[model samples]
Target: MDDQHLHDHRRLGRELGLFDTDPLMGAGLPYWLPDGAVVRHQLEEYVRELECSAGYRHVYSPVLGKRELYEISGHWAHYGDDMFPPMRLGGGGEEVVLRPSLCPHHALIYRSRSHSYRELPLRIAELGGMYRSELSGALGGLTRVRAIQLNDAHIFCTLDQAVEEARAALALIARAYADLGIRASRHRLSLPGDGAKYVADPALWRRATALLREVLDGSGIAYDAVEGEAAFYGPKIDVQIVDPAGREATLSTVQIDFHQPERFDLNYIGPDGAKHRPVMVHRSVVGSVERAVAQLVEQHGGAFPAWLAPVQLAVLPVSEAQERQAHDLAERARARGLRAEVAAEGSLGARIRAARLVPYQVVIGEREADAGLVAVRLRDGRRVDPLPSAELLHRVTARVGARGTELWADA
Candidate 1:
């Protein structure tokens, strides 16, 4: 990793006032500003659309849960070190821990209802906030934070349906990354080796690892076998991306788990009317929204694409005389579902510079205003001749709605 590139991103995020970390409140915990919250909401909306299209049901769960819950799900033994210490109530009673993952909570919900084979392929998703105790030294910007919102989902499928379900999850992940202008490398099917990191049961590990290889081989997606990266309970296929600075990060992951259901004593009636444990697949297309946003900020140098840009259009009036006109233009753009804003206070040149700093496509001025058109410049240095505001709106709306890169090009 280039230390300078990472440093540059930290500088940009701080300069933009998006987020901050304080040593007093503890490291790894970030406080998001209003502007940062807007970017987060935009990312959530995008993920929600993707999940809905992929047939995943959205649900909400509590951020804190009883101690026994994680204990039952094996997270206490497997993930306890990464979790915050339990909170003790005033009365002598059980303790609670802030949730580190949504799976255990979602699993409880599934077990609440006695499921049949008909609901075998149940996929529950949540854009849930989670907490972990990260080493203070590891915390930096939004990339490594104590509080994180994960695009998480868990799929409960029968043994026969495991491969198909895994493929569908992979497809959803691929489509999401592609749409967001993120390039994912070929999948890496991670298997457990005869190492301390893996489970001791060689037979069970072999079987679970083979299932992943079979699925990848059948799907015809090129993948390399990575040793010693499997989750404690099962094997996983990780979708990784090397960032602009050449640091490889796991962007998404799909794990096929066989042991968790058995450990939790989860069961469903199968087609043969026999009680069977459904296999669990834990997957996330975009690992963490905070991390993804950080990557995007560096990837595009904070000049986000129209669909993801916090402020899509920055309206600038040439002089005080055109201020009202600028405000009017901003309202019009907002009315058409674009995120448009007028410069609060500054010279025309200063306002344009400030606007450009936050990633916007068009900067309108008096010449185009007098001509009944809007002046537009793209991030890539392309200049477009002024066109009528309504026409410009149509073009922009189409591009934003379609999530097209050409809009950036055409501008």
Candidate 2:
């Protein structure tokens, strides 16, 4: 992990004005700047589109939950030490606390309505914010923090549909990783061991673990079985990728649980006209938005693709004579759903350098402006001849629309 290819996202985030944590506002909460928020917005919007198309219904949940809620979910008894200290209602009553995960609350939603076998794979998704109490020394940039938001969803399905749901989840993860241009090199079947941390049901635990392994094997995803990594509630398949520094990271996962449905008393009507418990599958396409963005910035060395770039195109005018033309071009790009900006006054080298980290750069001069052409620079340090305005726009739109990782140039 200590290679030049591996750089600290904290430093890169700072340099890019992405986010910051202030002591007065607390140690682990980050305030996202505009530049960072734009990137996050793009990531989340893309996630919503993907999940929605996959039949997940996005929903909103409250940040705080009753103490009894976690008790039923087993979090109060099994995971209380990691949670923030509980607070009493109206000075002294039922205790409430910030939610550390979205599963329990999501479980309550499934229990809210009666369901049928036909509606078996009902998935509810949320990019929910959660909180945990961490010691001061443990808090670092976005990667390790107290406050976090994750792409969380719980699937309610019959036992017969478990493997299929798991397959669907793996497909989603595969597509997401492919689009990000990163390889998910590890598929880990995380199972329970040592009756200490997980629910100690020997028979139930073994069955759940076997089902997850079957799904992974059936998909032909090579995985290593890891002991004692399953969630307190269930077994999971963790998709891990090699980060820039050669360290493995688990940011996407699919979990199957026979526990939550039973604990929450969730049931669905089966074809035999009998009520049966629905299995719960929890999955996240991308785990934590902030941490993923941090990973991405470091992965690409802070030069984001045109589609994901906070500012996709940087337009620079050589002199005051061409300033209006630059702004006009920027507006046109913006109208076409691109993030574009006009460069501030600076020397040619300075202006180009300022926009170096961005995907595309356009320099406007008197003759080129009159010719409806803009000189552009590619990420490979290749400065191409002035191109027709229509041609440049077409190329930029194609790259952004495809959300490609590289800004291609003719070598």
Candidate 3:
């Protein structure tokens, strides 16, 4: 990696006070600091808004499930090696396990109620937690972890609707990537290879793989078809991203699953008032919140986009005389929904250096405060001409609200 892209997220994460893992907390279980929580909360809110606008209903499911649940979903048979051992509640009591994926619970949710053809493309979304029994060697920063909060969703639809639903999911992922300043390295069609790791039904595998290929082709997305990369349940189109070290990892995916519906006996009423099976389309905009944030930390080199930055605006006072003005500016920013704080303890140069990564810095000096004006410093090191505090605040609020990639709206 070149010096320009040499910043590692683990290093930046610690320096920026974003997240940390401790021996007491165990590896792969990092806790978010206050600043990190703010960034994560904003990212999650953006996803929820996007999903809700696209006709997806948010849902909440338990992190733990009965052992029979995974067995029915075939995770116990096909993916047990990666799953934690089941927990027996008490002496000779029923066993439960931390869910390895949200798909099984979602399948059960779909089976809970009878649906009609009008509701064929029922989209259910969740920012839910799942666990993986990752080997100690594989565990690192947020990129690889045992506990993951996935941005998962499933669409229950007729076979004919599966391709379109998957395509729409790909579109959503692209839109999210653009907003987050993430670039896709490539798209991959992940299929089953010669092995017993997948479901036994060859016909189902062929059909599902064809559907995903159609989705990619129809969306005008060129993809590399790779075998042995598909999930145990079905085939998928994976969106890959390159890290600073030039390694590829999946950032998002759209999968077509036919096995789970059959295993769970999921059904809906057809237009003719007869029972029919609905295909399950599994997709994630950003695979895992922690991993996504880690990628962002590296991508931006700890200076995130305005709306996603932990502290959008830092108010700096030149001296004690302007301290009150600086705080007032911060309050105004907070009122407009931008994360802002005052830095009044250190010298003006020291405070500015400390807040260099902040998206915007408002420097209040005695002259500027007396004239009701403030000098704005952007993340890119550009200092704007003095402008009225209200005007600067207005432009900043507009830029942040729009989530524009530029540091300043005018720029």
Candidate 4:
């Protein structure tokens, strides 16, 4: 990429102190700075809240798993090329590798105990860390990183429950995109075709693919069915979205799998008093935290909305006399849950000028400090002067606390 063609995500990431990848540390391994961590934390919290309300039970699993685990899930055969090399312990242990995906471990959790049909669908979710060994030439900023943290979840349910589960996953994905003010362009139904990559179980593939189509067709959403893009295990629905610069990318997906459960021998007790295999649905709302953060940086051009900004408010004192007032005001804003701070060690004008992505800048002078008030400066350079401190805090906090999107105004 040339200097003129450079992605804003790479430029703004350093300018805003969001994230960085070190070639010395390793290619594609990014370190999130303090500002970046705050954004990532908010993303995780938002998704966790959504999953909780949707009846998903969160869990933790090992970062490294026995080679046999992937052997059963078929990753060793189908996806081994992308994974890191195996490591063996000195105590005569079997081969293990950093997990390339969390589904295999989650599958083992389900297999650990038997369930009744009453537990028709079990949803497992996690903000999981995973690794893959990609060619150095292919690695770029956060978008194509080797190390990633996933907003991943897996659902175990009966064959009859796949359609409802798939539809529900789509609903969550749609709601999330809408809340972020981004469009989910289209649903792409990825299928098996005349390729050696796809798993060959004609009867299972037919059944699974048909059920997924039923859900998409019933939902009335426009979609394109593409062949040779499905995973080896099964077919899936890939949601396509365009970035700020008109570049398209696959941001999220819901897959129907008939292979993993069968390979792992996972079963649930049926209403007929017999054991039956459960199906698996793999889904992610935001595929990788790093990539999502990059998208947000570019989407807003580093000017994040009030709710998600790392530094929501900056308090600037006109001189040493008003320094105490500045700090007190900052504390007051913090008590109200705003990420506020007192801007110290700079001229009043310099401090305000340095407020790049800060949504609100409060400038305190002699008259305002005496009247127990603040002067609010917005990103657009408009000033709201001489407001009571309490009132100032209320307006800013309301917009942030409500998570309001565009068409938002502060008091």
Candidate with best lDDT: 3
TM-score of each: 0.91, 0.95, 0.97, 0.92
lDDT of 1 by residue, 1-411 (tens): 455465355667777777777778777777777777777787789888888888889999999998998887667877788899999877988799999888888888788889999987999899999998888788777788889889999999988888888888888877777667777756898877674444466676777777778777877889988887777667899987765557677778888887767767889998798999988888898989888877767776677667877788887777787777778888988999998888858777777677774434455566776777777766556777877778777877888887644454354
Taking the tens digit of each residue's C-alpha lDDT, what string does model 2 give over 29-145? 888998999889998988998999999999999999999999999998778888998888785688999998999999998888899999879999999899989888988788778
Off by over 4 Å in 3: 1-6
Question: What are the lDDT figures for the candidates, one per model?
Answer: 0.79, 0.85, 0.91, 0.85
User: Which portions of model 2 show Cα errors greater than 4 Å?
Assistant: 1-6, 242-247, 383-385, 408-411
What TM-score would candidate 1 get against the native?
Answer: 0.91
Q: Candidate 3: global Cα-lDDT?
A: 0.91
TM-score of 3: 0.97
Candidate 2 TM-score over all chains jointly: 0.95
Residue 120's C-alpha lDDT in candidate 1? 71
RMSD of each: 2.6, 2.1, 1.4, 2.4
Clashing residue pairs, backbone N/CA/C < 3 A, model 1? 28-146
Best candidate (score: TM-score): 3
Instruction: After superposing candidate 4 on the true structure, give the runs of residues whose Cα lies further than 4 Å from its correct spot.
Output: 1-7, 91-93, 244-246, 344-349, 380-385, 406-411
Worst 10 residues of 3 by lDDT: 1-10
Model 4 agreement with the true structure over 230-274: per-residue lDDT tens digits: 888888899886665677777788998889998988999999999
Residue-wise C-alpha lDDT for candidate 3, range 241-349, written one tens digit per residue? 8778777899899999999999999999999989999999999999999989988988888888999998999999898988888888899889888889999887788
Ranking 1 against 2 by lDDT, winner: 2
